[model samples]
Target: MLKIDTVFYNKLLKNFKINIKYAKIKTIHKVIIGRKGKK
Candidate 1:
């Protein structure tokens, strides 16, 4: 019921946070690679 919903919501939130972190890391890597390619 309510408890289960909270657990599910928490899991989703955690996953969303992890995804955002990974996306940020990926963008940073892309920027570094682009700079390396220029030289």
Candidate 2:
């Protein structure tokens, strides 16, 4: 049971990290598009 919990925790952390990366990229893309619109 302990081992299973640990594995689940690791997967959750990995998914969280990936989500953060994707969010950052999305924000950056929005910023770029905003700048182009301003021009």
Candidate 3:
């Protein structure tokens, strides 16, 4: 149904956004820590 599809799509988009935000934060953390140091 259309409603179900919409809900699924919204969930997917929310997950994608979260993933992107996490990736960005991780990259920033790595940059701040430098390559030689342990995470």
Candidate 4:
């Protein structure tokens, strides 16, 4: 089951990276919106 464990770990790591990237994008969008609203 060591192979399965590695596969699962890789998937989890990938998902974590995707989540962080999505969060960064969302924050960037929010910052832009906020700046626009300030005008």
What lDDT is obtained when candidate 3 is compared to the true structure?
A: 0.94
- Candidate 1 clashes between residue pairs 3 or more apart in a chain or in different chains: none
Assess the local accuracy of residue 21 in candidate 2 as a C-alpha lDDT between 0 and 100: 100
Per-residue alpha-carbon lDDT of candidate 1 for residues 1-39, written as tens digits (9 for 90 to 100): 999999999999999999999999999999999999999
Q: Tell me the TM-score of each prediction against the true structure.
A: 0.97, 0.96, 0.86, 0.97
TM-score of 1: 0.97
Worst lDDT window (10 residues) for model 2? Answer: 1-10
* lDDT value for model 4: 1.00
Candidate 4: where is the Cα deviation over 4 Å? none
**Candidates' C-alpha lDDT:** 1.00, 1.00, 0.94, 1.00
Steric clash pairs (candidate 2): none
- Which residue pairs in candidate 4 have backbone atoms (N, alpha carbon, C) closer than 3 angstroms, thus clashing? none
Candidate 4 local lDDT, 1-39, one digit each (tens): 999999999999999999999999999999999999999
RMSD of each: 0.3, 0.4, 3.3, 0.3
lDDT of 3 by residue, 1-39 (tens): 999999999999999999999999999988888955755
Residue-level lDDT for 30 in candidate 4:
100
